[model samples]
Target chain A: MENNINDDNAPKTCEYDPNVNQDELIKAQEKQIAEEIKANTAMVGSLDGLSSLEEEYSNDPVYSSKVKTLLPKFSNVRRTRPDGNCFLRGFIFAYLEYCIHHRDELVRFKKYLESSKEELFEIGFPKFTTEDFHDMFMEVVSDLEGSGSIDRVEAVCNDAGTSDYLVVYLRLLISAHLQKNAEFFSFFIEGGRTVEEFCKQEVEPMYRECDHLHIVALTAAVGVGVRVMYLDRGEGDALVSHDFPEDKEPIIHLLYRPGHYDILYKA
Target chain B: MPMFTKLAHKTSTAAKSSGQTAAKTAAAAAAAKGNVTSPAGKHFLDNTRWQKRLQKELMSLLKEPPPGVTVDVDQAHTKLTEWVVHMEGAAGTLYEGEKFQLQFKFSPKYPFDSPEVIFVGENIPIHPHIYSNGHICLSILTEDWSPALSVQAICLSIISMLSSCKEKKRPPDNSYYVKTCSANPKKTKWWYHDDTV
Candidate 1:
């Protein structure tokens, strides 16, 4: 049905202007449509019930088993829009929400973040850029104090500017972590790429997908543990869980599919 | 050089007045007044984060500018969106002793969005990549722009572009493009095919 409409439109364009390069025009139109679709989708969404997951995996036994396991321990999943930056966004929202519950952890995280600013500046990030991101991050975190509500957190996280700024700051922190401890991280980096190179190629860019190396560096940098539960087709009755900052309890839980990550909230 | 310094000094003072504090007060007032819309019906509220970021950038650039770059806001004591950067051609290059001006127009979604940057001045540089009407065909100013790049880095890139030119010449299509191109070069889909200019 869609193909017939496209075919009809194609002949009409040639009729209007025979000189026009129809192929190039069609390609440009497709590109514009793709960009519009990307722009309309949010990077992160509000809290949603886990019924969607059940509906999604109802037919697939492997995924169904994973969902069944998660359903008993988790009540809700705040879905981060799968825009490549999902891991960072998921980590941030989950961590901030955790801070909202644990006051002392929030205080410690604030101090760590304050000191991390100087570390970022020392690593050759211009003071202006670092300060700008740091200030916005601090403002968002501070708002979680006292009467700060989850609704306010969701609003700010959903705001394009604030959310992107926070993501960039986290990327910087991850870069700083890897660079600061290059000797340790260099050992893990594959393909002869140095820690700095990895950060530039993988960590610094806004849309780069997060890898295990990124997860480790970020978890270490922010002084938080994250448990990523993998739900895949691999043979397993239970979901595979990998904890960052090994041997420690994780406060933040993330559900990881093939190429995306979202926050997992325990009941 | 002295004129550049004076201009920088003047702009810094102007920026101080309309910087963070002024933006905060404006935001507070807007909040109190409630739903202030512009003549165009767009919200009249300032993006405080963008204002603060630009203000900090302006302050830092003024305090410790890169070796060959001098920057000043386009308008004095007003919006921080537009900036005029002056670049001195690096010594020992074809453009040594030459000066150029670049106009940078930033959107509220700055850092995330690349600023619309173009060369501007009476005497535009005669370079293969730089058009007669001061449109620069540089990747970093367009597709290659990264949030990690700063105004200083852009100025340095432009200076280096001028410095590397062995012969002074306008782009091959300079005349035709200048006549037909839009006022804002950002709208142009520039095909940067040349490298050794």
Candidate 2:
């Protein structure tokens, strides 16, 4: 008794024969899907009025009702590519956008970043590789100091290499933080993997999606909190919002729809 | 060469203003010295960060390479992007007394992306996870690649992979895979079946 067996949207598993040969075909299919997405979207998209979200869900009573509740609070949305790095990309875009308007926060963040590279090096991260990414962040920060414009931030965030490098350094910093406090993080690490293994497999690699641990570690590492508004098919009239690190107020707001994340601007 | 060029297009060039104005000249120099990165591939060479990373890796490898591994220095200097690595089977491994050459092709996205590595010489190993076409099914070479891991680390991993092998035979579907696989082994989403080797 499977529901909608022939439905295109049905949950598709790669368990079709568990065939090793089919991997190439799967890769090709994934490439095609990624290319289609690339052609249709931007890495970091421009803002859209909250009404756009409401219109998208107008046909669905539950989602529409839930979206209606959000419209009063969140004024606009900025989308990022649904690439697995969406969480970090959306987080950085929203956070940087906030920092642009608030210069003191930007300076404080820059100061923190200035010391973080040495910290990462001391933690045994290869200086040769890590330095380039650290320098890129510095370049962007100093560039923002000069320009102080949203267009500059948007362009940097949208540039594939620059944006991806920012995510990489953030990932490294998160990995370093989690490893430094492995005693506390060990309890949360799933699959019995040690902190280092988890960091290598999950946190250090590009294109791997972030999890609860990632968000927790990142928020703690950067000392910037994020508020993720969860939107889903759950039985609720309004979206549930949770702030990372629970105690600190979340300055960065994001809309989390299952696996993907996008920026949210409050009115 | 097609393999290198196809992936080269994805390398990072956004931050090339970092004093690598000599990239085109260097690329031309490389082409004259028999490097596979054609002068046509100069844009791939213009990535300063990528070049710096590769040059550093090359210097370190030449200074003190891992056991049983040696980089073709002249070839690497000719083109920092493509390199030839010589390997001798470890003293006690099943592959003892045999030799292999691996080609390491770096894209402009080095460190961020894994280098494309494959056995390039005639003596492609007859190992359960290795194909006749010289593609080795190692996870670290693909999805498991991390910027933290360097070229030396990959060589060490491959060395360890060979040292731990208990048998000498091609993968079960070696022929079928070699026939249908794309020119670039990186294009295949490899499903590592057995880790025990």
Candidate 3:
């Protein structure tokens, strides 16, 4: 039997006249854009059962060794769509899942969000638009009171309107955190751009990828620690781990590979 | 290659079909109610969220009209997608005394998508950036539109665009472009070459 699974079998590129093939080029570009939109809109898989991490890493020794280390700790990996908001989505799912089990924590989180709405308004978010997003966020969280299951949570996250609302609400929260604690965060900013400018340009915009600063602000805002396990090609037999809110124990575990993020679960 | 060809064909056909539907809807509305029908297609109106958002925005605009701008739906409350904005030219500008009615056509995406805005009434502004066909070449109305932007912001931008005009004259390629341009300006790939206008 031949091992053709990882073979490079793409068709060779053909040379074409730019002037004559202008329409064709545009058609190709449009198709690519359509495909990208389709990919982004596709339903994300939640709480994927990865019974054995060894199967995924069997081809690479470094990754296999790293998996072996994690095998004792975790059993399943929740896969989010590789859309730009993956980190935020993963965080929401993992945090909500935690909330489902911890009722007191859920109540506390809800109360925090309720009180934070006024803070968000004070931070300069328009009340009308902000209220819509805040209402949706409240609705989703409030629905998780008694009958919350992994399946129900997955359904909510997969729905585009609700998911986008949650993501935007998270972004607003992060922005508010940065704005509120400008003195501490100003040092983390690279350029001379003030915290407000940075928040407007980077944090507030939809689909803006979360950086370290965003992660820090989000964790601080929600008061929930996140543990991100880096899975990369970097020379490491050991999987790298970083905890947000440095001293606190992380409730959510995320697997980070370059630009993408997905939730991880302990056995 | 075949897939690409099919996709291109489908898109063009869809555009043509939508255009015909729009024409028919306009005719029907004129005959029945003497009001302008929504420019948004059936697919756009089908989304409940889009419809609700448009209504909310419409209410907000009506409650608090922006300075020098009066906004109202083109049709009755039933048609929420199309809006007619009457803008009084800001003081100290070339168009100070002039009044222009802007036709705003909102898609289902509402805030997510930029509204198709053009001057509809008589006496279109003779600015260098404003085409004779009522299509105003503005960046914020096109590529620079963000979901964060509201109808109020759009009105402000248009006011600013008109305010900054030094001379009242048609664009350089006004005649040729107007003759060859599509009915919908959104379809036209506008190259924003000049910021000075």
Candidate 4:
């Protein structure tokens, strides 16, 4: 008896082309779908909170305008690429949050910083030893404490060299200290005045540029900053290699002449 | 199905023409009776040594994870050559609860060649440095990659990178992502620069 092809009990026939590998094709499709789901889920989960913070900041006209202006300038160099450095990105956001919160004080300090830069040039750069870097740190602290922005200065000091949070404050401090100041460069010369001379004449007056409390707070932060050089290098290189730390110390080789300092440790 | 049939016919024809000895023929005949392993089968079998090593390491990690992190490996729908991992970090800001998909494409060279890793996600955050596609711009993944570097090291570096991000800005050309991204994102290579983050 011949089977009826149209009967429901008849064996199923696949209508697909014999040349195609359906199983392989289906697996490929499934893989693609899985990847799509994974990617979308990751992005949505990470960005939701940041978007809200951005929304609030975007609403403030003055703050938004400044951010817009500064962003373009700061980011012009890396236009085509993405920054993979997450810690640095976080530090920058934190600093921006700081500036936005302290806008009025920032305005005042920016003005003082502009004038101080000129003085920095006239007074000259110091060949700061570890002690000089410390002294510089203390001087900034005293000035910050006097300025009544001691709280801001203290917060900065506490977090110093620990994260990139200090970069913003350091940028502000450097701007205030170095503007129009060509003299600070003099001490960096090979045979220039010792760090002692440079500290006495140049860094000592940093206190005058801002309130004494503010100066002291900033000074203490610098003490931490100077040590970042060590942390940046971390526990030295082993032959087999080791995982590098996230919070790298600043590459502070700038203060010491090329061959002068090799003590290596902070002791 | 067609491909398998074609391979089967070809293997049978070759076996008939070769006129192999009975002992060797019996082994192949048995293999064919069960399943016809492809030409790449030998390499795949040998390649599992490294795969096994990686899997064991991953399993050990899952049992006792690092601070602020969790990881999972999925093998359900991949080419045996590909390994996919999912990561989450609880302690880190901006990245907390964020799941990142890392796909690894191992080359035939195995442990010698570092696997290609890409973050696959749409609507990924743009930082001044991060491109629309999740190609990281760090040195370790490229010129600085050493055999000593492991999957955990790379993940940790990524976590650290996210934690340190200060600007919260995306790549400057984020608006162009839709225009420039390829139909198949995995094929595109990313350009990385800037020592200062």
The models' CA-based lDDT, in order, is: 0.70, 0.76, 0.70, 0.35
Docking class of 2: incorrect
Evaluated at residue B14, the lDDT of candidate 4 is 26
**Model 3 residue A238 CA deviation in Å:** 1.8
Task: Estimate the Cα RMSD of every predicted model relative to the unseen true structure.
Answer: 10.7, 10.2, 11.4, 29.4
RMSD of 2: 10.2
Candidate 2's residue-wise lDDT over A1-59, tens digit each? 65556678677673454334454455445555555555566667999999988889889
In terms of TM-score, the best-performing candidate is 2
Best by lDDT: 2
Q: Give the clashing residue pairs of candidate 3, or none.
A: none
lDDT of 4 by residue, A21-134 (tens): 433343344334434432332110121222232254586654444334333222211110011111222223232333345666445444544454434334333111122233
Off by over 4 Å in 4: A1-267, B1-47, B74-80, B89-92, B121-123, B175-191
Better candidate number, 2 or 4, judged by DockQ: 2
Model 2 per-residue lDDT tens digits across residues B99-184: 99999998776766688999998899888767888887876777667766788888988888888888887777777778767778
User: Positional deviation of A249 in candidate 3, in angstroms?
Assistant: 2.0
The interface root-mean-square deviations, each candidate in sequence, come to 15.6, 13.4, 13.3, 29.2
Residue-by-residue lDDT tens digits, candidate 3, A1-267: 675664467654764443343333333454354345435433346455655457877898877778777777888987776545778989998899899999999999999999999999898776777787788788878888856777767767666556666887899899999999999999999767689768865776555568899999999889999999998877767888999989889999998888888789998
TM-score of each: 0.73, 0.81, 0.73, 0.30
* Candidate 4's TM-score: 0.30
Q: What's the distance in Å from true for residue B150, model 4? A: 1.3
Chain B TM-score, structure 1: 0.72
Candidate 3 ranges with C-alpha deviation above 4 Å:
A1-43, A51-65, A183-194, B1-47, B74-78, B118-148, B160-197
